[model samples]
Target: MAFSAEDAKTASAVWEKIYADVEDNGAIVLSRMFKENPHTVSYFKNFTQLQSIPETASAEEIAALAEVRGHGKKVFSALNDLVSHLTNVDSLKATIVPLAKKHATELKVDVKDFGIIFENLLHLIGQKQGGDAKEAFEKVTNLIYEEIKAAY
Candidate 1:
């Protein structure tokens, strides 16, 4: 689904708020994704131990969590780039296609995993920012997922 100009504007404004603390928020989204769908962890070799980490984590677990946070930052940064270009479909598609190809080919990420990420991200936005932000982001995320699926 294509986002209207107003949808893009609203999503961009909300994204600015989230991106201010992208590292922490992104980590929360990824952590929530793993928790909600344990099967998805198999795709991340480095984070395979994520599910096994205890509340009182060991130093190793701490390092793993830190890595997850770092990866989360990268994930959100990519999203930020896409959201910033929402008003220009050509620019957005150019930016997303390469990353989608990398995930599909290099990472061998299952297409279904994108849906998991989309749902988790929406949940995070709804929980932290409220329904309006979630609604705005939903369109952007749907586009992202659709583009990725097509690329795959």
Candidate 2:
């Protein structure tokens, strides 16, 4: 979520595109974008690995992720924290937008498709947890998406 102004603009705009596609074509289309794009797949795979405990993650892994969880909470405290950092155009530009472009190229998909896959993967993670973890994860995830959606 270390976005710069341009990254924010790109991410925000791309999110709008993804939402529009979802609104117009639905989740299946979004899923198709992931299936069709390899860059999107790589982006998603990287993001998932970064954010979640791995499939074979041990208790130590869980503990490490727990620390990240606290860091995630701080980001959750402010909605704009999701992309507001993008006000620093250099940082944002350095990261997300390029990734977006790379995602489009690597996956042979649109930036919007990459966005939808990112969003849905988060959704899927939320679905996998139960009770408090589910609730907390969904809340943070929904907040992040809502901000991305609002930027449109």
Candidate lDDT (C-alpha), each: 0.80, 0.40
Report the C-alpha lDDT of model 2 over 1-152, residue by residue, as the tens digit: 33445545654553333233332223333334334443443444444543353344442343244333343333223323334444553543443454345434554444355256445434533444434343433433444443434333
TM-scores for all predictions: 0.87, 0.29
The residue pairs that clash in candidate 1, if any, are: none
Question: Compared with the true structure, what per-residue lDDT tens digits does model 1 show for residues 1-152?
Answer: 55688888899988888889898888777777666666667777676456566344543343348767898899999998899888888888899899999988998888888888778788878888999899888888888888888878
Clashes of 1: 0
Which candidate ranks first by lDDT, i.e. highest?
1
- lDDT score for residue 109 of model 2: 44
Give me the runs in candidate 2 sitting further than 4 Å from their true place: 1-90, 105-107, 130-152
Decoy 2 TM-score against native: 0.29
lDDT of 1 at 54: 36
Q: How many backbone clashes does candidate 2 have?
A: 7
